[model samples]
Target chain A: MKQSVYDLTQQHRSIRQFKDEPLSKETVQKLVEAGQMASTSSYVQAYSIIGVTDPDIKQALKEVSGQQHVVDNGYLFVYVIDYYRHSLINNETKGNMETSFESAEGLLVGTIDVALAAQNVALTAEDMGLGIVYLGSLRNDVERVGEILGLPEHVFPLFGMAVGVPSDDEQGSPKQRLPFEHVFHENQYNSDKTQQLEQIKQYDKEIQDYYQKRTNGKRSESWSEQIRKMMSKKTRPDILENLNVKGFMKK
Target chain B: MKQSVYDLTQQHRSIRQFKDEPLSKETVQKLVEAGQMASTSSYVQAYSIIGVTDPDIKQALKEVSGQQHVVDNGYLFVYVIDYYRHSLINNETKGNMETSFESAEGLLVGTIDVALAAQNVALTAEDMGLGIVYLGSLRNDVERVGEILGLPEHVFPLFGMAVGVPSDDEQGSPKQRLPFEHVFHENQYNSDKTQQLEQIKQYDKEIQDYYQKRTNGKRSESWSEQIRKMMSKKTRPDILENLNVKGFMKK
Candidate 1:
């Protein structure tokens, strides 16, 4: 037995590189079932998944995902947080009744439902001895991705997953995270000032050291440096506008 | 050893009723680590979790969660989708940057990051041989929940997880989902018009059957009836407006 879910969970990490082996249709069906088994909002199941296997389509997605392996290596799935189904039903019954602030709650539920389903897919892939990487970068160009996938209004791609066998070129290393004291509060939310700073500083050093080791002492940057670089920049795939276009009011 | 991740995944079902058994601190720590191991956006890790063990606090949360059993059962975790830490760093650096929608992309990444981390927490909890339920009803009163959690700006509670040894109050049955063809698309998104109605009809029967088995024939409703009840209604969560008051323009 795995003893604890932690054992399976502690094993989670993003795999960017992958082996060329392909996932069978049977395995893919299993993956989809795992996702469906995940908890849904009020059992509404407010999400849908699109699996891409065609080489040409996968290549197009690979470009969108910044050439991530799962798109090219084995199985690629785009998880869409959707309200379209509800909207269809609402139109039939209420004649365009807006959901007000509670409707915003529906958006969150959809997002959460997609997240839960995606997690199950990722973990189940791991359990099947497959390497997987989530392509958050897919949000970099949602319109193109939506067009490519033929996603209709009220359906937005939350993220993509590339899953396959791990290749020799792939080296899986656990990423450093901010400490427990910082991330996990007690009954109440606590910001342990000193502990947080000290732990972060230590974690920064560890990340820098890890990078140097991985790169044979070629590249190195502190966690703060990385954050500064990443935050001080901007990216594309205007998500808010897309959500609005998809019928969500950020208002 | 597990034969396939799919085999293990099929065992997943949200368990709300618990056995009144408590979890150890070490176990909780391990579960949190599993969550931490989940991928973060640009490695920002823009989320925090609060483990509620105090009976009083859990009781208040139980009410927020529509009196869900898991909320008061054993361990309750409020996953806060946060940007406060980023805001703090921005202020410290005099960066004058906001985690809000400078572009639509920012909002998507932040919210998606939060969702992904929370999903990891739920899965890990289940893997631990413990039962867990996601409390989407927490949105019923986000501000009150925030007040209870003492959440600062940019640290909003997204959803909650209640985990522990499951009790026999009610055994959960796998609810029927729209058939895979209805949800999963191939290379191009296919709206299978002909198959949709038949599949839904089958699903309505499946859901009705599931309710009959789970509730001992007490109550039943078709898919459309449930949708009419849930989707064709008006709901609002004022706490969401507070996001703007706190300086997050989700727009």
Candidate 2:
């Protein structure tokens, strides 16, 4: 049976373009309320979301994010991995609460908490027939984003999500995934699991063919070639020292 | 108008006690399939999930997590923040993908990507009438968990989600939340938004009352007080430096 959950799963795709329209206040409220309804950790609810609506601010964010369509197209949400609220609460209660970055574990909890909440909001928006894109580029200059959001110490912007009704030609196919066998392991992780190599090669061919078809066979390169080009040109942010400065240890 | 998303949101809660019944193979398949359907970064899909079924192993994890219900519960899933697939793909293509501590962006992407997927599984599980509790405590001993799962470098254990049908007594009330004003911000963040301090204080009182009513005031304390006690203890894992060893740089 084609289950409803699987149906929802099949419906997900990253949307980069949107119709020129603004999101309603009611829609924003519903999205955030549904997000708050997400499963939070220890009821600490250690995450904060900022909704950006001012076109001037959106234009600035678009520049910061390399002119991504989502930044300027519709509703942009900056999800912050926040422990600042707990710190505030701690201050109120005296020397009770603390934000210690002794290990990667602390950072992991905050990141995951924000991720879960954001996904819930994304799904709820999609259920409302809106398209969405997650702005990983927000990290390109997270400090800028933090400043824009007026974030305090212990609250780092994990990333942003942009949501809106899709323009007609904005549909994109599901990006091919490594087979479930490659990603999922049974009892112990099997690194030697290359039984799908040949299948993946076929997938590489399929990807190249799809790109060619998209460009009328003008650009024909395998997935490996594309990855090589992308990897060779390092575009990652200088966030290592930034996290340390913001209070997370590499430990 | 009441939104269906509201109903779905209200359905989320942490379920600790579960019947000894095992989840069918079909159930696990459906859950993981839903997870795989989550939106990923650049379609890199940088995450993997491992399902634990062996009772002995489950018991061991339960001990590690310091939660009795871990072994006695339904399906326990360890959502892993993984960049190993990209590394392998890099190897195959001889793509010069950097695997340095400076890959803070990759780690964040992996952690956030997997977390988004895990949250989907939680929601899908709930839709199937199941309950879930995210166990952040699993990070208390990263080395042990890594050993148990045979995790490779670049694949860090993010969090655990214990999923199953809830036993009647296990139903906990919605944990009191900070007011909407405290958590949500408009175009820009208001850092000194202590205007909501009164609301937070009210929540603290509500949580203390909840604990007292449930425990006959045996462990009466405000939310802030409980958080203080939790932060007072230095019981986190010793795997912070290990991230650097695993190729993550704190800067």
Candidate 3:
């Protein structure tokens, strides 16, 4: 099922249900190889992939992630924003640690690095005829996830990805996204929502239909309704606290 | 010029200097089209590309970013971590503003959204035979960049990408990064730097060679040496202050 990366990218669907089949070591290596080739921030390479092959750990990660696919998948990896390794090098050479790696810039750049590498992994996994589901829910219990992985300071877990062969459980088509014009704009940001309002109303209907079909009418809500429900209250409040405890920011 | 996205990704080298030709409007539109198809976090679509096409705005951005390619390049876009649009939609739907848009998780996820979309643009631009250089230096004056772009409270300029045809200025080989083992540890983070020190030392030699050849020996420094020099001093100290002022985090 080798295909153009763009084609695979276009065809991407998060596989929450994965087959029992396990990927070979060689295949996983290929994915990591693609990940390693991703561009890093100034070659700081401030991201690390902690592959969790241990079943007990996977089960625990699944518990915290609120996603059962994490344990059932052929492979799982916790992507972390890492500055620990670089700090060691800083210690060795400069004799004193702490630099850009301890600032807000570090968190921003490191998160970008992790995402870039994970997108590479996702795209390459799709190319290799595999399925992936990114687990942002891992942040539901960020502190325990860190304890489980023994992640040290200056290393914050950002997200998780579970990859494996597809199962029949994950049926249906790719999810609908906002139309191009709404999300993207020319030259300057036309922050005026007036232009995109009607289009989004239409998209809400499409999403409502998608949710209807996806959940067998168990949940059929418009996109905005969903947003209203989600954003009506605070989302994960502990994330920044976790990051701060991990030393991602300096006062 | 058209190649597999993976091939192009592996061959990606940020072009600091670009030819003095401007990209056509249609070409850039296609790039953005590709960008819009990138994966978003929970369909929040929390990012916006602020294109700076006006020569004056581009000049100001270039001055603040300290990257000439931004002004010289055929196309320039400052990828912003945006929740302002969502806030508008929330305002319309939920009648009030604050939601995930102003949380720590929001910042993390929005940053991922921007990078994923930007990487798609980079790859598509490469497919179109153009070169791109990401301008993290834009963070050097994050607040100023935000003010220059007229960014709203919930929108922040994360990074910039300058795209155009390749110039003869960057004639050297690609930059050297840490080898596969150093980057892609398997099943666990081999955080034991003691195990990887010798390998990184070997990699330092390779980086030294790369910098020497690229800079014509005006600078020949090892990877650790460079990391030490860079890490020895703080960079972008204003980033957190700017993010705080921009309202990205809640207590």
- What's candidate 2's i-RMS value? 3.4
Per-residue lDDT over A1-251 for candidate 2, one digit per residue giving the tens place of the 0 to 100 score: 22344466667888888998889988887788778878776666778888888877777777778856845566888888777766676676676344442246667767877888898898788877888888888888877877777777778888889899998998667766656665677755555537545645766787888888888989888765665566555556567667776666534
Worst 10 residues of 1 chain A by lDDT: A95-104
On a 0 to 1 TM-score scale, where does candidate 2 land against the true structure?
0.91
lDDT of 1 by residue, A1-251 (tens): 43345666676677776777889999898889988888887777888899888888888877877764735678888899766665555555664434631245656777778887888888888877787888887887788888888877778888888889878877656777887877899999875555555666787788889889989999889776677667765566366677777677543
Evaluate every candidate with DockQ and list the scores.
0.57, 0.51, 0.49
TM-score for each predicted model, relative to the true structure? 0.92, 0.91, 0.92
Residue-wise C-alpha lDDT for candidate 2, range B1-251, written one tens digit per residue = 32344467766667889987778988988788789889887666777888888888778777789998778777888888776656666767676576431277777877888888888898788877788888877877777888888888777777788888788788566665566666788888767746546656778877788889989889778877766676655446465666666555443
Residue B227, candidate 1: Cα error in Å is 2.1
Query: By lDDT, is 1 or 2 better?
Result: 2
**Please, what are the lDDT tens digits per residue for candidate 3 over residues B41-140?**
7777788787778988888888887777888888898899877767767767655546477778888989998988887787767767788888888988
* 1 against 2, candidate with superior TM-score: 1
Kindly report, for each predicted structure in the order presented, the TM-score of its chain A compared with the true chain A: 0.90, 0.88, 0.93
Give the CAPRI class of candidate 3: medium
* Global lDDT scores for all candidate models: 0.73, 0.74, 0.78
Candidate 2 segments whose C-alpha is farther than 4 A from its true place = A1-3, A93-103, A193-202, A209-216, A219-221, B1-3, B93-95, B99-102, B213-219
